[model samples]
Target: MRPSVSKPPACLLLALTSIFLNAQTTSQPVISADARTVQLERRLETISSALVAARQQVDQSLQQIHELQQELAEIKQQLPSAQTVPPNSSSSIADPLAALKTSVTDVQERQDTLEAQVKLHDQTKVESDSKYPIHLSGLVLFNAFANRGNVDNIDLPAIAISQPDGASGGSLGAGLRQTILGIEGSGPRIAGARTSANVNMDFFAGLAYANFGTSAGIVRMRTASINLDWPKDSVQAGLVGPLISPLSPTSYATVAEPGMAWAGNLWTWAPQLRYAHQFPLQEDKHVQFEFGLWDTPSSGYNTSDVLRSPSPSEQSRQPAYETRVSYGTSSVDRGLQVGLGGYYSRQHYPYNNNDSWAATVDWRVPLGARFEFSGEGYRGRSLGGLGGGVYKDVLYGTNPVTGAPAFVGLNAIGGWAQFKSHFTQSFEANAATGQDNGFADDFHSIILPSTATSLQLRARNRMIVGNLIYRPKTYLIFSPEYRRIWTWPIYGQGNTADVFTLSMGYQF
Candidate 1:
């Protein structure tokens, strides 16, 4: 019975068996959840490690940024402060542009100061050199001459003390007429004023083999003077010859004809004071004027007698005065020149009784490429005893009376003319004539045999002269001259003389 039950439940038993068989035929593999969870943890750990390393790099960068900020703060602290510059600031401030400008300014100021000082030094040197100056000069003259006699025979003594002889002769001679040496100089200003002076000496030697005995060796003062110049004019004082007289056409030197007479009367040196002024007149033209007072020597017989007896006292006699005015024209084409001048002079004798006055006119004419001629004429008058008087007296007798007494009267006239021939530039000719008259015939007669006699005297005198001069250069002059003089009633002796002479000279 059981077997039947165990074997059969046919539907149930078969379903169960079928299910078991199907499960076994379609089986699937399976894993634990814990193992998966462990893998997940490991991956998460790797990710965390990477994140930590990134965070570390970021922190390091931040630290480097903080250090850089500190360094920037230190750099800012080292920079200059912008505070106002202290008054006593010794430490230089940092301002490149301003410093450069200040340096440039200082350098410029120093340079200007140096330049000013140099300019001052140069001006001082120039002034000093101008204030003090020196000069030197000299002149030498040589002369040759010939003479012809034209006079009545007269007894004349010889140098050997032999008896007087009546001998007529002619002569040719040579001489060193004058040798001059000069020095001039000036001194620096004192109290804004300057001073100057000049001195010169001359040596005159007599001719040899002329039969005329003379003191051959002699030294003389040619010029000596002191000058003081002001802003407008100048003054000079010294023992000087008559400057105006020499310049006048009728003066002694100018009137002395070739063979007639020599210039300048041998007289005592006259001391004088003079003043001169110069001013511009017109374009390239000028004018100059000068005046002076001179001390006239004694005229009357006394130890101080200069020319004659009855010498006037200084206080009673009027001072000798001279004046000159000159006008110079402009230097036109080729430097031509024209001039005009006038002069006047007066003198008083020691006796106060004799007075003299003179007037002169001068002229200069130039012919272009031909020559130049200059001339002058003077008129002189003497009143009272000045007409005539004894000039000098010696122990034995008396010298020729130049300034004589006894209604003395004098009239003198002279002139000179020069010409240059076109044929020779170095060749020139000069001629001159002079005349002096006393008109004292009546006075000479009354004075009869007395040396002071003035009546019956043919006082008229004549001088004729000529010169042919050859100038090789400015410094050399070769001249052959002829001079003639005719005197009537010579010295109240009713005698006459005609003299001729020739001369040559050199200059440098």
Candidate 2:
């Protein structure tokens, strides 16, 4: 019976198998549809990427085209006009494609050329703006001064007597006190040596109530010198002004009294040879020494003909010999400077004998800005021999009152102190005392004497001076001054003169 029931078992099994195969076949179509959807998504992504890349390429191409067009325009402007172009056959000129190619090539070449030219121009500008060592500079000074009371007459003869007393009120005058032009240059060594030089001149004119009429004018050599610099050394030579004196180091200030023996009497010019050597005392610290040979006499009673007279004999003779020494510290904070100098000259005139010595001390105190003080003392002696003595007695002495030596020795001592305080940026003041012996009495005896022989009565005299200077800027200065003079050995009785002066100076 089981066999009969199972007779369909195999067939039943086959039927089950067939049902499974049909189900599997039906699932394949759905799987294929999903695969097609994925492929379509991938293709869309690829197309989007390609579109973005194409847009970027188009933008870059447009930028290049814009630049090329600008270059083409510039090249056209530089091309020759019809007047410069040679006539050609119509067939040759009709080839627009070749002409366009040629124009494009030319524009490219011109753009490259212009870029190179701009670079060259920039390089040239940089070179021209570089700093050089050569320099040209100058200074001009305009001065105006007025005097109240008696002013010393510089135009009178050196032997003239009597101070002029007229028109004591006021006067107007103008002058170029220091008209200097010069050139300076420095550079690396050439042929193992360095060289430099400076040349200057002064053209001056002024008006005063004097014998030279209402105006006095002159042109003089201010400075002429050449300097040679070695590794740490230098040498200079020429007709140079004195290196001494703080006020009148370059040129004499002729506005002051003439005969008084301070800065005025110390004024003179001479030829000199000078040498300087610098040595390092420490790192960034140095000390210098200078020595000079000033043309002058050795000693005795001989005069300098070049200074006193222009005669050939005088021109060749020396005037005097002057020596100077100075020492300075490397540290400005140390505030120390000391110097000593002297001169000895033979009498230029028969009875004139001259010898002078001076010492100076200057100190500075470190404060907010700085405070400075300096003092100088000088002494001089003039000897009058027998002939001078007789001249003095006859001119100044009463007849037969007593027996006296005709000649006498005249001695003078002078001192001055200067103090400056730099308290603020806008203001500074300087006060000085310039007084000497033999300023007034010599004037009365020699200038305003009652008799001709009164010239012999010249003796030691004194002048007291005070000055206050205000400097608002580096190039502008205003000074007001006062002077009092006292003469000794009264000839026409003791005479004194009080002088007040105001001076304004501008420089650029």
Question: What lDDT would each prediction earn against the true structure?
Answer: 0.47, 0.47
Off by over 4 Å in 1: 1-134, 150-165, 189-195, 205-215, 229-232, 248-269, 297-318, 330-352, 383-427, 439-449, 452-458, 490-508
lDDT score of residue 439 within candidate 2: 34
The TM-score values for the models, in the order shown, are: 0.52, 0.51
As a whole number from 0 to 100, the lDDT of residue 89 in candidate 2 is 61
Best by TM-score: 1
- What's the lDDT of the predicted structure labeled candidate 1? 0.47
For model 2, residues 1-508, the per-residue Cα lDDT tens digits are 6678876988999999999999999899999999999999999999999999999999999988787677655555544341323467675577746645766787667678789868864563322122434445555544444433333432211122344556444334444543455555554565566866666555533443476644344545655677777876777786664434322211112332222333223433456677767776655545556666555322123375346534211343554444555555555433445656554434333343333223332223333344566555555443121111111211223223344322223444454555665444334454444444433333333233345333344443445455555555556666665555554344455445555555566543
For all predictions, the C-alpha RMSD in Å is 33.1, 21.1
Backbone clash total for model 1 is 27
**Clashing pairs counted in every model:** 27, 19
